[model samples]
Target: MSKRKKSTTAFKKANKFIPGGVNSPARAFSAVEMDPIFIEKGEGAYLYDIDGNQYLEYVNSWGPMILGYNPPQVIEELEKQLQLGTSFGAPTEVETEIAELITEFYPAVDKVRMVNSGTEATMSAIRLARGYTGRDKIVKLEGCYHGHGDSLLVDAGSGLATLGIKGSPGVTENTARETIVAPYNDQKAVAEIFNKYGSEIAGIILEPVTGNMGVIAPQRGYLEFLREITYKNGSLLIFDEVMTGFRLSRGGAQELYAIEPDLSTFGKIIGGGMPVGAYAGKKEIMDYVAPLGPVYQAGTLSGNPMAMQAGLTTLKALKKEDVYLELEKKGQKLEAGIKKNIEELNFPAYFNRVGSMFTLFFTDKEVQNYQDVKECDLDLFAAYFKEMINQGIYLPPSQFEANFISLALTDSDLDKTITANYKALNKLKAEL
Candidate 1:
C-alpha cells in the first residue's frame, strides 16, 4: 500500500472548516472513490498537486480553462487591471467592451447582464423569463443541470407527467413543483407538456449539448424542434451554455446547430478561469430586470474589473481563426485515439465527444440521457480514475462528467494522455 494514496487525513482536517473538504460536491471525488488531491498550482495543460505529483489535466477546471491555466495574455491583462483597481461599484468601460464582444459573437443576444457565477446567470435568466411571460412554471430537460438555483434543484419522479422531487434536501417541495421535467431529445414529450400547461409555462430551458451528463449531444433536428414548439406555445427557450459556450464554437452550441434560443446563459471560457457568468437575450425580455422592469436582480461584484479583464483577454486571444480550427483538429485526433484504445482492450467503455469536451463511460450502452448514464459502472470508473491519477493523467473524478482539453496541450501531450489511458485500462483489468 502506498502512503501517498491515503490523503484522507488532510480531508479529515479540512472538513471542520469546509463542508466535505470541498465547496463543490463533485470535487470531493464522491462518484470516483479517491481522496481529493489538493492542487498546488497549474500552468498550461498541467496541474501540480500538494503531493508533488504533476498531471496532464483533462478536466481543465470543469471547462473554464480554455487557454489552460495561467495563459500569458490573460495574466498580463490581469496584472494591468490589478494595478488600476479591483471592484468599483461604479461602471467601467471594460464591462461594456466585454459585453460588446460577447454580443458580436451571439447575433441573437441584444443585451447581456453580467453576474458572479453560472448559478447567478441561470437563476436571473429564469426570473426574467417568468416575469416576461407572467407565468409560474418552467420546463427543464432531465439531467440538464443549470445550476443550484432553487427552481432548478429538481429530480424526475415516477411518470412522464409526474411532478418532480426536491433533488437536494434543503430545496422545498414548492420550489420543486415550479419546475417541470421532460426527457431530452423527446420532442413529443415536450409538446405534450406544453399542450397540458401551455398558458402557465414561462419557458423551456436546456443545455443544447449536455456536458453535465457526459457530453450528450442533441439529436439531429432536436434543437430546431425545441425552438419551434416553444414559439408555438408562447414560451421562451433558454440555452444553458455554461459548458459549451466558447468551447464548442466562438458563438457556442447555437452556432453549431444553427438554432437560436431566446435567452442563453454563459460561463466557463468567458472568464478565462476567473469567476464570471452572464445571461443575454432579446432586449424586450432582458429589460424586465431592475432599473427597467419589475423582476429584481443585483450584484455588488458583478462585472468586477478582474473578471472583465481576464475574460476580454481570453476572448481576444481566441479570436485568432487558427486557434479554433486547431482545437477541433486536436479534439478529433484525441477522440479517435481513445476509441481505438477502447476497442483494443475489449473494454466495455463508450466514448462521446464534441469539440474539446469528451467523456468515457464505463458501460457498453450508448449514453444519451440521465437514465442511460445511470447504468454506468461507477465502480469501474473509480478504479480507472485511480489508475489514471497514478499514471499522471488527471480526468474528471466522476463517471457522469465531461473532460475538457485546452489549447495549451500539444500533440506530444495528447499522445502522452492516450498512452496513460491505455496503461490505466490495463492496470484496471488486471485488478478485476
Candidate 2:
C-alpha cells in the first residue's frame, strides 16, 4: 500500500470540522472503502498529496482542468485580474467578453446569465424553463445528475449513486413529485412520462452525453427523438451540458449532434477550473429572467472578474483548431490501451468513451442506462481503484464517476497509465 500516513492524519483532523472530512461528498471516497487523500497541490497532469506522493491525475478536479492544473495562461490572466479585484458583486467588461465568447461558440445560446457553480446554472435554467413554459414540473433522467439543487437531487447519479442513496433526506415528497424521473436513452419511457404529464412539464433536462452515469452516450438518433418530442409537446428542451460543454467540442454536444436545445446549462471548462457556471438559450426564453423578464434569479458572485478572466483565457486557448483533435487522439489512445488490457485479461469489464471523458465499468454487459450500470461489480472496481492508486494513478474514487483526460498529459504519461492499469487488473485477477 502507498504511504498515506499524512493523508490519514489530515482526514482524521478534517472530519472534526468538515462533515465527512470533505467539502464534496464525492471526495469522501466512501464508495471505494478508503479514506480520502488530502491533496497539497497540483501541476500539469499530476497531483501532490499531503503524504508527498505524486499521482498522474485522471479526475482533473472533477472535469474542469481541461488544460490541466495551473496552466500558465489562465494563471497569468487570473493574477492580472486579482490585482484589479476579485468579486465586484456588480458587473465587469470581462463578463460581457466571456458571455460573447460563449454565445459565439454555442449556437443555441442567444443570451446567457452567469452563476457561481453548476448547481446554480442548472437550477436557474430549470426555473427559467418553468417560467417560460408556464409549467411546474420537469423531467430528468434517472442517473443524469445536474447538481445538488433540490429539484435535481432526486434519482441523481454521481455521488448519490456512489453512496447508494436514491434521493436526499430533506427534499419534500411534493418537490420530488414535480421532478419526474425517466430512464436514460429510453425514448419510450420519456414518451410515456410526457403522455401522462405533458401539459405540466416545463422541460426535460439531461446530460447530452452522460458523464455522471459513467460516460454513457446517447443511442442513435436518441437526441433527435428528444428534440422532436419536446417540440411537439410545446415544452422546453434543456441540455445540462455542465460536463459536456466545451469539453465535447467548441459548441458542445449540441453542435456535435446537430440538435439545438431551448436552454442549456454549462460549467466545468467554461470557468477554466474556477467556480463559475451559466445558463443560456434563445432570447425568447432567456428574456424570462429578471432585469429583462419576470422570473427572479440572482447571484452575488455571478460573473466575478477573476472567474471571467480565467474562463476567457481558457476559452480563447480552446479556439485553436488542433486542441480538440489532439484531445480526440489522446482519448482514442487511452481507450485503445484500456480495451486491450481488458481483452488480454479476459476481464468482465466494459469501457465507454466520448472525446476526452471515459469510464471502465466492471461488467461484461454493455451499459445503456442506470439499471445497466447498477449491475457492475462494485467490489472488483474498488479493488482495481486501490491498486491503481498504489501504482501512482489517481482516478475518481467512485465506480459511477467518469475519468477525464487533460491536454497536459503526454504520450509517456498515457503509456504509464495504461501500464499501471494492466498491472492493477492483473494483480486483481491473481488475488481472485
Candidate 3:
C-alpha cells in the first residue's frame, strides 16, 4: 500500500461551483470525518485513487457494480450503441426489448415506464398511485431512502443520516405533512397508521431489505404484514428497490420475499453505470401512468440508447445463475470471518448481513432501525476506516452504510479484506 496522498484537490475546486463539492451528497465524505478520495478509475473489485493508491473496493459504486466495474460485455454494448446514436427523445425497439426482459424476470411488472433515475421512478410511481387511488398521503419507513424526489424524500436515510439533515430545506411543512413516517420492522405501527388514516393514505413505500441502515433485513413476516395492511386499507404498496433491485436477484427483493408490490422502482445495475431508473407494476396500475392514463411524467433522456445497452448487457451477463450463488458464498464467508473476529477480539460490535450485503456496527445491540444504528461508536468506526484504508481495503465511509460484494471479489479478495479488517479492528482497540 502506498502512502496517503493529496487527491481531494479537484473536489475542493468543485465545491466552489457545486453544492458540497459533490453532485451526490454521500460522496462528500463528511460522515467518515475525512476528505473524499477522488477516484481515477475502477476495475473489477479495485478502486485506484487519484493519488495512485489501490484498494479492494467494498462500496461498489454504492451498490451497483455487481458484475464489477466496466465489465467487457457491458462496455462492448455501449460501444455498439455509441456508433448508432444516443438519445432520440422518441422510441426505439430496444426499449420494448428491455421492457419485455424486465417483465419476464418480474411478472408483476406487466407494463413499465423507464425514467432517468430512481428518484424519477419513485416520484412517478407515487404520482400514479395518488392518481389511481385519488388519495393524498403516502407512508414510508423512517430510514428507507427512496431518492431525492420531494414527496418520497420525507423519511429518507443514507446521505440524510450522514449529513445530519432533519429533512431537505425546500420541502414545505405542508408537503412533509402529506408523508407519514413509520418505524421499520414494526407491523403494529404500520397497522395503526393504516387504521387511523386508511382512506387518506394513497400508498406505502419501503426498501424490502434496507441496505441504507446497515443492511437491516425485514423482520420475519414484516413484508407480509405490510402487504396485508395496504390491501385491506386500499393503499398502494411501492418497493423502492433502487439499491436492492438486480443485486438481490434478477427479480429483486420482491422475488426473494415472494411478495408482489402494486408498484416498484429500480435503478443501479439496470443502467449499468449510466443514469437510469424505471417503475413497473400490474398493467392496470401502469396503464394509469402517461399517454394511456392521466398521471403525466416525461423525461427527455429517459430510455437513452446508451443507458439501455449498458443495463441490458449487464443483466444478460448476470443471467448465469452461478453468479448469485457465488455472491452468496462470498457474502457468507465475509460475514463468518467478521463473526470470528468479533469472538476472538471480543469487540463490542455485531454484524448484520443478507445475501451479498453486510454491515459491521460498533455496538452490541441488535440493529433493526436507524435508532439502533445511532448508538454505535462512531469514533471506533472512524479509526477503523482509516486503518482499513491504510491497509489498502476500501470500506464504506459511514457506519450506517453496508458493504457490497461483487462477482469480481474472489476468495483471495475476501481473505485480504478479512485480514485487513482484523488488523484494523485491533488498531482501533489500541487507539481506544
Candidate 4:
C-alpha cells in the first residue's frame, strides 16, 4: 500500500470542472468520509490505483465483473468488434443472438430489449407494465432500488441511502404519488396495500434477493406470498435483477428461488463489464413495447455491437464452466472465516449472504428489512472502511452496498481478506 497523494491532487483539479469532483455521488466516497481513489486499471482480483497502490478488490465494479477484470474470452470478443467498428445505430445480428441467449436462460422471458444501463431497463419496464395493464399506480418495496427512475426512487436504497437523501427534489407530487412504497419482507404491509388498492395498482416490483440494502434475503414464505398476491390482484410482478442477474445462478434469483416474475430487468454480468442493460418478459408483455405495439421506446446506442459481443462471450463461458459451484465454495469459505473472526472478537453483528453476495453489518440486531438496515452503526462502519482500505483491501465505501466475490479470486485472496478483516476489527475493538 502507498499514500494517496496522486488521487488527492487529481480530486483538487477535478473539483473546478466537476460537481463534487465525481460523476456519481457514490464515487465521491463521502459515505466513508474520504475522497475517492483514482484507479488506473484492474487485473485478475486486484485494482491498481494512480498512487502505485494495489488492492485485493471486493467491489468488483459494483457487481459486473463476476469473472473479474479483463477475462480473456470477453476481451477477445471486444477486440474483434473493435476492428469491425463501434456503434451503427441500427439493427445488428449480434443483438438478436445475445437477446436469444437471455430468453433461453430465463424461463419467464420470451423477448428482451437491450439498453445502455440498468436504469433504462427498469424505467422502460415500468412504462410497459402501466401501458399493458392500463393502470397508473405502481408498488415497490422500500430500499429495493430498481433504479433512479422517477417512479421507483422513493425510499430507494444504495446510492440514495449512501448520500442520506429521502427522495430526489425534482420529482413532482403526482409522479411520487403513483408509487406506493412498502417495506420488504413485510407480508402484512404488502397484503394490506393490496387489499386497499389491488385493482388500481399497475404492478409490484422488488428484488428477489435484495443487494441494495446490503444483501438482505426475503423471509420464509415472503416470496411465495408475493407471487400469489400479485397473481390474485391482476398486477404484474417485476424482478429487478440488476445486481443478481447471472451472478446468483444460471437463471439468477428466480432459478435459485423457483419464483418466476412477469418481467425481469438485468444488468451487471450480462454486459460483461461494458455499459449495457436489458428488460425481458413474456412475449405478450414485451410486444407491448415499440413497433409491435402502441408503447414506444428507442435508444441510439442500444445493443452496441461491442456490448453484445462481450456479453455473449461472457454468457457462453458461464454456461460452460462450473461458475456457480465455485462461487458457492468461495462464499462459504469467506463466510466461515468472517464468522470466526466475529466470534473470537465477541462482536455479535449479523451477517447476510446470498451466494457470492454478502455484507457484514455493524449491528447486533438482525437486518431483514430497510428499517433494520438503517439501525446499523454508521460511525462504526465508516471507521471499519478506513481500516480495511488502509490494509490494502478494497471494499464498497457504504454499508448499503454488497461486497462481491469473483471467479478470478484464489484461495490466497480470500485468506488475505480474512486476515485484513480480522486485523481491522481487532483495531476497532481496541479503539472501543
Root-mean-square deviation of every model: 3.2, 0.8, 1.2, 0.8
TM match of model 4 to true structure: 0.99
- In terms of lDDT, the poorest run of 10 residues in model 1 is 156-165
lDDT of each: 0.86, 0.93, 0.87, 0.92
What lDDT score goes with residue 31 in model 2? 86
Clash count, one per candidate:
0, 0, 0, 0
lDDT of 4 at 110: 99
Query: Candidate 1, residue 41: CA error in Å?
Result: 0.5
Query: Is candidate 1 or 4 superior in TM-score?
Result: 4
Residue lDDT tens for model 1, 288-405: 8899989999999999999989999999988897887999989998998889998998888999988888889889989877788778887898899988887888888877678998
Across 112-146, the per-residue lDDT of candidate 4 in tens digits comes to 99999999999999999999999999999999898
Give all TM-scores, in the order shown.
Answer: 0.96, 0.99, 0.98, 0.99
Candidate 2 regions off by >4 Å? none
Q: How would you encode candidate 3's per-residue C-alpha lDDT over 1-432 as one tens digit per residue?
A: 665456667777888998988888878777778888888899998999888899898998988789888888888888888988888888998888888888888867899899999889888999999999999999999888888888767767888887777689899888989999998998889888888999999999999999877899998899999999899888998998888888888888899999999999998888888889999999999999779999999999999999989888888888886888888999999999989988898788889988888999999889998788888888788888888988998989988787899999989999998898888888776766
Q: What ranking emerges by lDDT with the best candidate at the front?
A: 2, 4, 3, 1
Give Cα distance to truth, residue 164, candidate 1, Å: 16
